[model samples]
Target: MPTPDLMTAELTLTGRITTASNATFLGSIGEVEVVYKPIAGESPLWDFPHGTLARREVAAYMVSQVCGWDIVPRTWLRDGPFGEGMVQLWQEQDPVQTAVNLIATNQVPEKGWKQVLEGQDEDGQMVALVHEDSPALRRMAVFDMVVNNADRKGNHILAMTDGHRHGVDHGLTFHSDHKLRTVLWGWLGDPLTAEERDGIDRVTEGLNGGLGRNLADLLSVEEIESIATRCARLRLEGRFPAPSGEMPAVPWPLF
Candidate 1:
């Protein structure tokens, strides 16, 4: 169970995420929109330990910070009705604006799967995927691969109206084994830009300093090693593309 602190105030529920695998509540503490998840009393799918949920949530925020993108939600540990649990800041986005919907609308040219998340067209349909050729997107691909994220579905990406792309649903991250599955497969075999290489180097360097110590508390040694190995491989290959492996590129259900 999480130790209660004074700053951890009770949250008031305003909505519910019925489609999620876990019981998630959309609520607010003061003026902040947040989502709450109580500890499992009966069945737990991921079977997380008492404090692992909060730790993993924090880990996601740390990774996002290191990636130079405020793409992840702010997460913290808090006392819940059931037990210790995790809470995340809820982002206000268009209910219909998702990577999947944006891509499937076909408002953009179908060069490949890369036409996803570009933007809406003049006729209010989705345009081509803009991040397909960006250095930032390439770095994100490497980050996802290192984390072994198995559920990088289109819906997981939140495309803000202000041109910011945020990714959510990171509960399945940090798997000790390789299990990466994502939809950003358009960059396979493309050479990494200079900026992309520098970002990989930055990530590798970060792992040797404070960032490494912070992750050490939440992730296992093997997981940390996986992060290092992925960075090294990307640096050596000098390319941003789909990795050659027997694993599937997409996860089931798309979310």
Candidate 2:
């Protein structure tokens, strides 16, 4: 998306992203519903250690675009009512009452927690949280690991009404080293499926050609190498790579 000027005359604040660690405003950049990061928000969180979250978000968007996966928010660098930072078009999700809800709810059954992205019920009715993990979802997990996504909580997985899973929030990615933290742990020791392996191969081959060139513009050579290394390790090991550092395997406050 083309970036708008800092002094845009038509932007309007419609909502606030209170879920994020820092303050963010939801506004329209032209006709898109975008979450804007203004300078007026609170200072960065000391524990997270992102000097500029907006920059990382934009970089992650670029990576997603090159990877041929529309898992990221439609991001762009622009100035909004808040200030200059990354802006993303908001995604809409279904509001069904389900078995595994990301957000807290009291009405859901205790045995099977109602999730935000439920699947069909026993009676063929649409339920909350979908059942059965998908190849696309697994692919997204590998991509998240490659990008060093620091935040991959359940709520971040936007389950669209059409059965598509969209991952969001890339502000904490590409830390120049192994810093992956996520919740998609379905395929811990399982072998990569054909499609999953094919995707990895595609990325590996792409890195040798146009993909590397494109990533180099936004990420360091070492960062890109780490991505390749991780991909190779997963392919060779036929399992999810284990963490070497002392950091927590999952991000804090999983929900």
Alpha carbon deviation, residue 44, candidate 1 (Å): 4.6
TM-score of 2: 0.75
Best by TM-score: 1
Where is model 2 more than 4 Å wrong at Cα?
1-10, 39-50, 97-132, 242-244
TM-score of each: 0.78, 0.75
Give me the displacement of residue 133 in model 2, in angstroms.
1.8
What is candidate 2's lDDT per residue for 1-255, written digit by digit as tens? 566553454668888878777778878756667677753564666444544567667767766666666778677666665567667778887777211243323344544221333345446665443222565577678778767887887677777777667787777777766678776655566677776666677777878987787667656677778778877877888766655587776666666
- Model 1 lDDT at residue 2: 47
lDDT per residue (tens digit) for residues 139-218 in model 1: 56766765667778767777676756677777767766666787776677788777667666776888999779999988
Worst 10 residues of 2 by lDDT: 97-106
Shift in Å, residue 181, candidate 1:
0.4
Best by the lDDT measure: 2
